[model samples]
Target: MWTKEFFGTDVYHLVSAFVIYSMLGWLVESIYMSFCNRRLTNRGFAKSPFCPIYGFGAIIGYLILHPLDGHFFKLYLLGALMATVFEFLVGNLMLKLFGEIWWDYKDKPCNYKGIICLESTIAWGFYAVIIIVFLHSKIIGFIDSWSFSMGSRVCSLILAIVTIDYIIQLSKAFGIDIRERCADKYESFKARWY
Candidate 1:
């Protein structure tokens, strides 16, 4: 009865929500990168509009705003916008403080002439927005109506494991034989694209 009253026994709503959120994350990241960070387009990081980081951020946002019921959609959008602002501010500040670019997007379409990448920043902002909106709207009750108690737990666990694995691989690549090779390849790749 509770499920019928809330989610209406249809998982499509959840699926659609995630899809839209992920798309928003991609759009926001792409737009920010294009307008704010010109170097990303010149590099190559913005080549693909679909980024794992943004998707992950969307999921995080969804979870945070899951309790808002009918207002979840509005909360999600607001959260996403808030996240965008945060990303913009934090990114510009970091670039101003640091002389070296930590992330490069030489292959993407950016408008800024610096060592700033807006992809990750967008993702971070998106996640932050979701959390803030969810907390503000109290949507956790609706989320509880779902059948899966372990859903969020399971997803978080998987994400952590995968992220750790990727980090380890990147570390090994940086330290091992692939370091120079990857760098060279990346350089060539940048040259080809930009």
Candidate 2:
């Protein structure tokens, strides 16, 4: 079908993993933040309702921790360190590129450049154990059950939509407010009604 293998793994399955993990991560973050802030916040870099960081992190975690699936103690300890490094790098990269910090942990204890904190890193370890023990098998099986042809087609569709959303969000960063006109219209309509 498409060009070829995506870094050895089948492109379809890889993308499926991204979409699944991103969606689940987004849901969890949104729900958790809603309770913490007492308001809805769609936490992610993209306009679409998923965080690629979580997707990438989950994939990376799965790759590294899957082999140690039954060993919770080692898995948790190593996973925490790996995830902390990943989180720090991603945070720093985003800050440099966007001229904004997506998150700040400076207020928390044992933080580094507001990119990460001890508590969060330990929490990542807990998440790693859960993913390795509970989610990895189910997600892998679900993706494997899909025929490549069918799976690729579906992955292509979802990836296309996500790519477009990413482009739009990038444009917004460059003073291209694609959403401005629609938002203004909505405000006027609301004013007239209420």
Candidate 3:
């Protein structure tokens, strides 16, 4: 019974795995940026860590590929390819429409034209690899045990973060001085109410 319980479905484990992998990707990129100590610039997008576009892309990738089984290596490769395509298309479209790049990898070894960094690509690839390997090996059966509610909650958290980040960025793009505006509004409200 204990053994069965230990191996039972645990949505928390799946959510934790996703969060860990995402955070690891951010950490790796931050380390790379720190070593360079230069603001990354590129032809297409703006430089930002909390890119909502990439967040959405990642989520999409998970949705599309997570249901498939068999041929772990092949699936991983296909997922990587899909991710790359998504990144490229989204980056280009954003540049064309908004005239800003959401990320910059200018100084990194794997960066090309500041638009796409090799580190990010490799990180995403590794993420897919981990999922594929784990699912195939059944070494950690937690993912299979995860509850739907837990999975939805995790995805919701990610989406909320991405939405907030995007809103901040849009405000920046429009040159809205949120800090100053908020201060002025607060002072006015205080004077009127008091």
Best by lDDT: 2
On TM-score, the leading prediction is 2
Off by over 4 Å in 3: 1-21, 35-55, 96-98, 104-126, 135-170, 187-194
User: Residue-wise lDDT of candidate 3 within 32-95, one digit each (tens)?
Assistant: 6666667642211123344334334544555566665456666667777777777777778868
Better of 1 and 3 by lDDT: 3
Give me the overall lDDT of model 1.
Answer: 0.49
Q: For model 1, state the Cα shift of residue 160 in Å.
A: 18
lDDT of 1 by residue, 1-194 (tens): 11233333234334333434444556765676677766543221233333444444555445555555457456546565655554455456656754334355455455244333455445444455545554323433444555464545444454465456555554664465555777999999999999
Give the TM-score (vs. native) of candidate 2: 0.82
Give the higher-lDDT candidate: 2 or 3.
2
Clashes of 3: 8
- lDDT string for model 2 (50-83, tens) is 7888889998788777889899999999999999
| TM-score of candidate 1 versus the correct structure, residues matched by position | 0.31
Off by over 4 Å in 1: 1-24, 37-48, 71-175, 179-194
After superposition on all CA atoms, what RMSD does each candidate show versus the true structure?
13.2, 7.4, 8.0
lDDT of each: 0.49, 0.85, 0.58
Weakest 10 consecutive residues of candidate 1 by summed lDDT? 1-10
